[model samples]
Target: MSDRELRPLRSIRITGDGRCLFRSVAYGACLRRGKHPPSDSAQKELADELRAKVADEFVKRRGDTEWFLEGNFENYVRQMRKPHAWGGEPELFMCSHVLRMPITVYMYTSSSDGPRIIAEYGQEYGKDDPVRVLYDGYGHYDALQPSVVRTQSRL
Candidate 1:
């Protein structure tokens, strides 16, 4: 695509703490579901609330299946609900199910293969949903803001 044809995309950085993934998902969810996108402060509040709710859902689901979660489920859920507690693949899967929406994680890398899809959960269930997230190859997550197009007339 030509330079003008391609609109530049930007990433809004999320906290690098353990809650980064959850917070990024929460921000994306709010943008998708809310009437108007909430401010950053409100987004943080929403993310905090989502963290607890997703953690609760994770704990509840543990009872239905055996050998699903490693370690004590109670402690796992407890740590998950707290801010700055690192979230991994399990939490990513649980968040997708609990939110009932797809979570597409884009992973950038230095490899010649280019960026990759690290995870795409609940997509089949919510095919029309635009909610997704971007992961910087490093240990951080960020929200991808929609790219804006500028025509010559506008320029």
Candidate 2:
């Protein structure tokens, strides 16, 4: 969101954040060696405090709120907790306002099915709805690859 409060067409992610995740990925890879990996970046210091703040903040604003991550991130976060720094819970950032979205072959049991899912999640809109669910969606790792994106763009 901007000063005008209009949602942007795309997110503004700095390469530094990408490097941060890459560092985590490298750390994850190094852990395959069955040893505690050495820290290589300054991101770890503020990471937990930031995540806790984000989670707590989400919890505060979550009453009757909905959120979307645009991927099957919840499960991946569960499988790789330390790397992602996400607690293994679908409702990790519990808030009435935050509706968890994980793009997967499986939808959450809490959610209703079909096109109605969009209407239900996006009901905040009056005549025109703001929320949408593109079902049969991509998984966590599928989204990371450029090939999947190229194929998806044609759709």
Candidate 3:
């Protein structure tokens, strides 16, 4: 659908207090499961949990590729667990793979027709369900839920 047709039904804004990306992903995961996102403290806790889980999974599954990592796996995991780590494409991909959840990111900027899908990870396991994350050009992320319109009624 076009951007206009895909306006958000609701949005959960994530604070840019150094961990917006992690929080965004955490919130998106909840949305994917058809559940409400957690509060700030809870979201932070969830993000921390996700970070640790993803880090362990990465080492277990991709430890051989440690050379590609900027630092040792231990340090990588340590940084990831920090609240100021600032998750990025690598983290997003890892999270998607580890969690088996499809993630779709929409970026809104001055040079775009509208909010456009900037990144996606993971294969849809059922019903092609995907979690969505929105990135504002100014440096913040939010969970975006598309509005669903019912056009017909049962007779």
User: lDDT per model, in order?
Assistant: 0.70, 0.29, 0.74
Put down candidate 1 lDDT per residue, 2-111, tens digits, no spaces.
22232244567786667788878888787768656556677678778878888888767876622666688787777777887877667777778878887877776777
After superposition, which runs of candidate 1 have C-alpha atoms over 4 Å from their true positions? 1-9, 64-68, 112-114, 150-155
Residue 87 error, candidate 1, Å: 1.2
Better of 2 and 3 by TM-score: 3
Q: Taking the tens digit of each residue's C-alpha lDDT, what string does model 2 give over 1-155?
A: 22123211121121233233323322322333344543544335433433444354444554432244334544433333343543212222231123232211112244643212221221332223122222222221100111112224554
Question: Model 3 — which ten-residue stretch has the worst lDDT?
Answer: 1-10
Quality of model 3 by C-alpha lDDT: 0.74
- Clash statistics: count for each candidate: 0, 10, 0
Cα RMSD of all models vs. native, in order, equals 4.1, 14.7, 3.0
Ranking the candidates on TM-score from highest down gives 3, 1, 2
Lowest summed lDDT across 10 adjacent residues in model 1 is found at 1-10
Off by over 4 Å in 2: 1-41, 67-155
Q: What is the alpha-carbon lDDT of model 2 when measured against the actual structure?
A: 0.29
